[model samples]
Target chain A: MVLLLVAPAVAAGIVLLLPSARAIMRFCAMGTITTATVAACCAWRTFAGGSLQAGEWFRMDMLSAWHLVLMAGVFSAVSLYAVGYFSKELESGAFSRGKAARYAALWFGAMDAMTVVLLTDNLGVMWVGIEATTLLTAFMILTHSSPASLEAMWKYLLMCSVGVALAFIGVILAAASAESAGLTGAQVLSWTHLLDAAGSLSSAHVKMAFIFAVVGYGTKAGLAPMHSWLPDAHSQAPAPVSAMFSAFMLNAALYCVLRSLALVEAVTGSDGWGREVLLVLGLVSVLLAAVFIVGQRDIKRLLAYSSVEHIGLIAVGIGLGGAGAAAALLHAMNHSVAKTLSFMSAGRIGQAYGTNDMRRISGALHAEPLWGTGLLLGIMMLAGMAPFGIFLSEFLILKSALEGGRYLLAGALLAGLVAVFVGVMRHAIGVSWGAHEGIVRNVGAGWLDRFLVAGAILVSLVLGIWPCSRLWHVLEMASALTGGMP
Target chain B: MMPLVDSVHVLILVTCLLLLGSSRLGACIRTVAIQGIVAGGVLPWVSSLHISMQLLFTGVFVMALKGIVFPVLLSRAMREASASREMSPFVGYGTSLMAGVLFFLASLWLGAKLPTPDGVSGLAVPTACMMVSTGLFLIIARRLAVTQVIGYIVVENGIYALGLAVAHDIPVLVELGAMLDAFVAVFVMGIAIFHINREFDHMDSGRLNVLKG
Candidate 1:
C-alpha cells in the first residue's frame, strides 16, 4: 500500500529529471506498473486479512484496498497507453518534448494524489488529496493547445473547486455534529471514530451534512445536474487522461460518497434518506446521459455520458444497501476495468481517425484491426451486453432493487439502462461500421495497446463467467466495513 | 448583562447581508474583509487559552491574507477584466436578497430546534449557518467568476465564524493549511480567468459554453 502511494511520487520526481520525452514516458510506465503490482499486493493482503497503516493518518482496509487496486490497475494501463499515444504525437512534432515531459510528471502526480485520497483516513487530508488531483490533472486536460481544451480546463477547475468548497462545509458540519455529541478534538472528524459513535451523532445535522457531501462529491462523480464539467473535461483531455478520468477518478469520487453514505446510514439507522436522494440523482443522471449520448458528436463525450450512466448504476446500487452495496462494490471494480478499456480503445481510434466525430469515423475494423476490435468489444461490454461483468452487475442491481420492494425504482432503472444501451449502441455502431470515408492513419496499434485492451477484456469476462472467491471475499469484507450485511 | 457574543453575532449577520445585498464587487470584497477583521477581533474573546504572540500573528495573517489581500487581488482581477457590476444573476438579486433573509430565519429556527452544545452560545451558530448558506447562494447565483470567488471567501468566513463559536483545539497547522489552500485556489482561478478571456475572448461564464453536451 505504501509502495502504491510512494511509487508515483518517486516517479514524478524522476520524470522531472529525465532528459528526453522517451525516457520520461518509460519512467512513468515503469512506475505505474510497479504501483499496480503493489496495489494488487495490497488487495491480496487486505483480503488475506493483513493490515497496514501510517500511524493513524493512513490505513488500508478492504474498502481502500479495493480502490487502491483499481486505481493502480487502471492507471498502469493508461500509463502504458500514454507512452505509445504520446510518442506518436512527439514523433509528429505536434507537441514539443518539453510539453510531453511535463505531461508525464503531472500524470504521475495526479496518480499519486488519487492514491492518497483512497488511503487516507483523515477527512481534511483527503480533501487536500482530492484538490491535489484536480490541480495536477487540470493541466493534463489542457494538454492540447486549443481554445476548446483551455475552455474545458477552466470550467472544470472553477466548477469543481466551488463544489469542493461545499463539500468542506459538509465536513465542517459533520464535525460540529460530532462536537455536539461530546466527541471533541480530532475524534470529532476521524472516520473510524465517527463511525463508531455515529449512532450518537445529531440526526438532523448529519442529514444536512450528507446532503452537502453528496452534492459536492456528486459533482466530481459526474452525477447529473452537477455534471456539466465532465463532458468538456473528458472530451477535451488527451485520450489516456480521459480514460483515467472516466475509469478511476470517477470511482474515487464515488468512494467518498460511499464513505459518507456509510456514516449517514449508521447515524440515521435507515438508508431511506440517502437512498431517496441517490435514486433521484442516479435516475436523473441516467436519463440525462440517455438524452445527451444520442446527440453527442464527439465520441469521447459520448463515452463521458456513458460514464455518467455507469456511475448512476453504482449510485443506485449503493442506495439500495444490503446485497446492493456488495453488488455496487463489484460493479465499481468491473466498470473501472471495462470503461478504462473502452476509453483507451476510443482514444486510439480517435488518434487514428484524427477526429472524434462518429460521422467521420467508419470502417475502423478494416482500417486498424486491433484498435477497431478493441473499440467494438469494449463498446459491447460497456453497453451491458451478455457475457460481460457489467451485464451481471446491472442484473444484480435490478434484482436487489426489486427485492428491496423498490419496484418502481427497479423499473425505472431498467428502462434507463435500456435507453442508454440503445443510445450507446447507436453511436458505437455509427463509429465502428457506419461509413468508410476520410479515415487517416496518424497512429497505429502497438503491443502495449493490444495488451491493455486484452487485459481489461479478459478480466471483465473472467469475472462475469466465474467470480473469484477471493474477490467475493474482499467485497463481502468491504460491505461489512460499511456496517452492512455482507 | 447582555452577552458579548450576541453583539458579535449581530455584526456577522449584518456583514453577511451587506455581502448579499451589495452590487459592487469592490464593496462586496471590502465587506468580506471587514467581516474577517471582526472575526479576528472576536477570536481573543472566544478562546479559552491566553493568546500567544504567535497566535496573534496568525490571526493578523488571516486578516491580511483572507480579509485584505485576497479581496484586493480579486478587486484587481475585476478591474482588469472591466467587470464592475455583478451582472444579472441566475436568481434575481431581489429574490436572492429575500432568500438571504429567509436563510437567516431558517438558521434561527434550526438553532432553536437543536440543543446547543454546552459553552457554545446559541446566537452565533445560527447566524454563522445562515451566513454560510447565503455565501453558497452567492456563488451559485452570481455569473462572473471573480464574484463567485468572493462568494467562496464569504463562505469560508462563515465557517470561521462557526469555528469561533465552538472554539475547538484545531491545530494551527491545519488552519494555516486551509487558508493557504484557499489562497492558492483563488490565485489559480484568477490565472484561469485570464486564460479563459484570452482563449474564449470573454471572462463571462455565460458565454463559455463551447464544450457542453
Candidate 2:
C-alpha cells in the first residue's frame, strides 16, 4: 500500500529528467501504467482478502479499492490520450518540453495525492490529500496560459481552496464527535475506529459535520450552485486535463463526500438524513446542468455541464441507498469511460476546426472521421442511450428509486435526463454531420488512438450488456461498505 | 490556560475586524499576518490533550509560515500589482466593520447551539466561526484579488483555530500536510496574481468575467 503512494511521487520526480516533450508524454503513459499495475494488485488483494493496511495510517477496503480500480483505469486512458492530444501542440510549437515536464510532474503528483485520499484511514489525511490535488492541478489548467485559461485557473484555485477549507470544519467536527465518544490520539481521526464507535457518537455533531462536508466537497465535485468553476476550467484547460478532471477528479471529490456520508449514516443509525442531503444536491445538479446544456455554445463547456449532470445522477443513486448505491458505483465507471472518449474526441475535433463553438464548427464527420465518430458515439452514450453502460446504470438507478417508492424523485430525475438527452443530442448531431465551409486538415489517428476509442466503446457496451457476476459482486461489496443498505 | 486561550481568541477576532475595516491593502495584509500569528501562537495552549514536543514544533512551524512567510508573499504580490488602497470596495469600510460585528454575534449564537467536548474553551468555537464568516465576507465584498487572498488566509486561520479547539489529537503528519497545502495555496495564488496582473494590467477579480455563461 505504501508502495502505491510512493511509486507515483517517485515517477513524478523521474519525469523531470526526461529529454523532450514527446519523451515526457511517453514517460507519463509508462508511469501511469506502472502505478495502475500496482493499484490493480492492491485492489485485487483487497478483493481476494478483506482489506489491506499499511501501518496505522493507510488502508483500503472494498470502497477505496473500487475507487482505486476506477481511478487507475481513467488515469491510464487519459495518460495515453495526452500523448496524442499534445502531439498536435508539439507540432504547432504550443507545447514546449518544459511545459510537458511540468504537466507530467503535476499529473503524477495528482495521482499520488488521490491515492493518498483513497488509501488513508485517517479522515484528516484524506482532506489533506484532496487539498493537495487542488493545488497541484491548478497549473495544469494553464498548460497554454491565455487570459481565459488564467481566469479559469484563478477561479478554480480560489473557489476550491475556500470550499475545501470549509470541509476542514467538517473533519474537525467529526473528530470532535469521535473524541467525545472517548476515542483518543490517532484513533479520533481514523475512519474504522469512528465506524466502530458510531453508536456512541454525538449525532448532532455528526449531522453538522456531514452538512458542512457535503457543501464543501460538493463544491469540488462540481455539484451545482457551487459548480461555477467546472465549465470555465473545462473549457479552458487542455483536453487531457479536462478529461482527467471530468473523469476521476470529480469522482475523487465525490468519493470524499461519500465517505463522510457513510460515517454520518452510521452515527445517526442509518436513518437516511445524509442520503437525503445527497439526494437534494444530486437533483439540483442534474436539473441545473440540464438548464445550462440547452444553449451552451462552447463544446467543452457543454461536456463540462454533462459531467455535472452525470455526477449528480451518481449522487442521486447513492442517495437512494440500496441497489441505488451499487448502481451509483457502476455509473461512476461508465461515466469515466464515456467522458474520457468524448473529451479526447472533442479535443481533436476542436483542433481540426480551430474553435470549440458548436455552431461554428460543423461537418465533423467530413473533417476528421475517426474523432468525429468518437465524439458522436461518445455523446450518444453519454445521453444514456441503450446498450451503453451509462444507460444501464441510469436504468438501474431509476429502478431502485421506483422500488423504494420515491416517485417524485424518480419523476424529477427522469425529467432532467430527458431534457439533457434532447439538448445534448441536438448539439451532437449538428457537430457530427451539419454543413461546413473550409476543408479541415486531417490530424491522422495513430493505432493507439484507434485502440483507445474502440476499447472504450467496447468496455461500455460489454458492461452494459453483460455486467458479469464478479463485477456485480464487487459493486455490492463496495456499496455495502457505504452502509446505507436496509 | 483557558483565559489565555480566550484572550488570544479575542485578539484574533480584533485582527479580523481590523482586516475588514482597513481600506489599505498593505494594512489588511499586516492585520491578517497578525491574526495568523495569534492563531498559531495560541495553538499549544488550546490543545484538548496534553501538549507534546511535536505539538510545540508544529505550532512554531505554522506560526512562522502563517505569520512571517505568508505576509511577505502577499506583500510582494501587492507591490507587484501596484494597487495600493482598496478603492471603493463593494462594501464600505464602516459597513464592513459593522458586518464584522454582526458576524461575531451570529457566531456566538451558533457556538451556543453547538455542543463542544469537555476541555474546549467556551470562546474558541465562536471566535473560529466569526473569523470564517468575516473571511467569507471579505472574499465576497472586496474588489481586489489581493484582498481575496487575504480573506482566504483568514478563513484558513479560522479552520486551524477550530482544529486546535476540537481535535488536538490530529496526527502531526496530517497537520503539517495541511499547513504545507496552505503554504502552497498562497504561493500558487501569488503566482496566479502575477500572471493575471501581467495579462489584464489590473487585479480586479470582479472584472474577470469574460468566461461567463
Candidate 3:
C-alpha cells in the first residue's frame, strides 16, 4: 500500500532524468501505467479482503477502492493521450523539453497527491491532499501560457485555495465535535474514530461542518455558483490536462465531500439533511449548466459546462439514496470515460481547424473522421443518449427519485437533463456536419488515439447494455459507505 | 499569559482592519504579515495550553513562514509587478473599513452562537472569524492580483487560528502538511502574479474577462 503512494512521487523525480520531450512524455506515461497497475491490485485486494490500512493514517475501503480504480483508469488513459497530444506540439516547436519535464513532474505529483486523498483515513490529511492538488495542478493549466490561460490559472489557484481553506474549518469543527468522544491527539481527526463516535457528536457542530464542507469541497467539485473557475480552466488547459481535470480531479474533490457526507449523515441519524443539501446543490448545478450550455460557443467550455451538469447529476443520484447512490457512482465512471473522449476530440478538432468556436469549425466528420465521430458520440453519451452508460445511470437515478416519492425533484431533474440534451445536441450536430470553408490543418493520429477512442466507446456501450453485475455489487458496497442505503 | 493572549488578539483585529483600510499594496502586505505572526503566536500563548515538542516546532515554523517568508515573497512579487496602491478598488477604502467593522460584529454574533471548545479563549473564535471575513472581502473588492494573493494568505491565517482554537490536538504531521500546503500555495500564487503581470502588462484581475460565457 505504501508502494502505491510512494511510486508516483518517485516517478515524478525520475522524469527529470529523461533525454527529450518525447522521452519524458513516454516515461511519464509508463510511470503512471505502472502505478495504476499497482493501484488496481490494491483495489482488488481491498474489495476481496475488506479494507486495507497502512500504518495508522491511511486506509482503503470499498469507497476508496471504487474511486481508486476510477482514478487509475482515468490517469492511465489520459497519460497515454498526453503522449499523443504533446507530440503535435513538439513538432510545431510549441512544446519544449523544459515544459514537458515540468508537466510530467506535476502530473506524477498530482497523482501522488490524489492517491493520498483516496487512501487516507485522516480527514485533515485529506484536506491537505485536496489543497495540494489545487496548487500542483495550477500550472498545468498554463502549459502554453497566454493571457486567458494565466487568468484561468490565477482563478483556479485562488478560488480553490480559498475554498479548500474553508473546508479546513469544517475539518476542525468536526474534530472539535469529536472531542467529546475522548479520542487522543491525531485520532480525533481520524475518519474511522469519527464514524465510530458519530452518535455522540454535537448536532449543531455537525450541521455547520456539513454546510461548510459541501460549499468548500463542492467548489472544487465544480458544483454551481462556485463552478466559475472550472469552465475557464478547462477551456484553457491543454486537452489532456483538461481531460484529467474533468475526469478524475473533480471526482477526487467530490470524494472528500462524500466522506464528510457519510459522517454527517451518521451524526444526524440518517434524516436526509445532508442528502437534501446535496440535492439542492446538484439541481442548481444542473440548471445553471443548462443555461450556460445553451449559449456557449467554445467547444471546450461547452464540455466543461457539461461536466458541471454531470457532476450535478451524480450528486443528485447520491442525494436520492438507495439505488440512486449506486447509480451515481456508475454515472461518475461513465462521465469520466465520455468526457475524456469529447475533450480529446474537441482538442484535436481545434488543432485541425485552428479554433474551438463551434460555429467556425464545421463539417468535423469530413475533416477528421476519428475525432469527429468521437466528439459526436461523446457528446451524445454525455447528453444521456440511449444505449450509453450515462443514459442508464440517469434513468436509474430518476427511477429511484420517483420511487422515493421525490416527484418534484424528479421533475426538475428531468427538465434540466432534457434542456441540456437539446442544447448540446444542436451544437454537436452543427459541429459534426456543417459546411467547411477553410483549409484544415491535417494532424495525424497514432495508434494510441485509436485505442483510446475505441476503448472508451466500447466501455460505454457494454456498461450501458450489460450493466455488469460485479461492478454493480461493488458500486452498492461503496454507496452504502456514503450512508445512502435504505 | 492571559494579558499576552489578549494583546495578540487585539493585534490580529487591528491588522485585519489595517488590511481592509490600507490602499497601498506594501502596507497591505505588511499588515497581513503582522497578522500572520500575531495569529501564529496564539497557538503557544494561550494560558490553558500544554506545551509539547510538536507544539513548539509548529509555533516556530508557523511564525517563520507566515511572518517572514510570506511577506518577503509577496513583497518581491509586488516589486516585479511594479504595482502599488489599490487605486479604484471595487469598494472604496472608507466603505471597506466600515464593512470591516460590520463583519467583526457579525463574527462576534456568530462566535456567540457557536459553542467554543473548552480551554480556548472566548475571543479567539470571533477574532478568527473576522480574519476570514476580512480576507474574503479583500479578495472580492481588490483589483490587483497581488492583493488577492494577500487576501488568500490572510484567509489561511484565519483558518490556522481557528484550528488552534477549535482543535489543537490535530496530528503534527497533518498540521505540518496543511502549513506546507499553505506555503506552497503562496509560492505558486506569487509565480502566477508574476506571470499575469508579464502577460497582461498589468495586475488588474478584474480586466481578465476574455473567457466569459
Best by DockQ: 3
CA RMSD for every model? Answer: 2.5, 1.4, 1.2
The Cα local distance difference test for each model comes to 0.79, 0.91, 0.90
Q: Write the per-residue lDDT of candidate 2 for residues A1-486, one digit (tens) a residue.
A: 888889999999999999999999999999899899889999998988989879998899999999999999999999999998899999989999999999999999999999999998998899999999999999999999899999999999999999999998999888888866889889988999999999998788788899889999999999988899999999999999999999999999999999999999998778788999889999999999999999999999999999999999999999999899999999999999999999999999988888899988888987788899899999999999989999999999999999999999999999999999999999998999977777675788999999999999999999899999998899998997775685
Worst 10 residues of 1 chain A by lDDT: A477-486
**Candidate 1 at A269: error in angstroms?**
2.6
Ranking by lDDT: 2, 3, 1
Candidate 3 Cα errors over 4 Å, as ranges: A484-486, B1-4
> Using Cα atoms with residue i matched to residue i, what is each candidate's TM-score against the true structure?
0.94, 0.98, 0.98
Better of 1 and 2 by DockQ: 2
Model 1 per-residue lDDT tens digits across residues A1-486: 667778788888888788888888888888888878878887777778655676667888888888888887888888888888888888778766688778988998888888888888766667677777777788899788788888888788877877776776667667767865677666676788788888788887678778878898899889998998999999999888999999999889878877787788888776466767887898889888888887788889988998998898888887777778778889988888888887888888888888888878988877777888888888888889979898888888889999989898888888888888888888778777755776377577777777787888899999788887877767867865554652
TM (chain A) per model: 0.97, 0.99, 0.99
- Per-residue lDDT for A229-323 in model 3, tens only? 99999999999999999999999999999999998999988878899999999999999999999998999999999999999999999898889
Deviation (Å) of B184 in candidate 1: 2.2
- Give DockQ: model 2: 0.81
Which candidate leads in lDDT?
Answer: 2
Candidate 1: lDDT of A444?
74
Evaluate model 3: give its lDDT: 0.90
lDDT of 1 by residue, B1-213 (tens): 126766777888888888788788888888888887777555435533455665677688887887667877888788778778876778886787888889988988866755555666678668778877887888788878777777777777776666555435444555566677677778877877777766766677766667666
| Pairs in steric clash, model 3 | none
Error of 1 at B31 (Å): 2.6
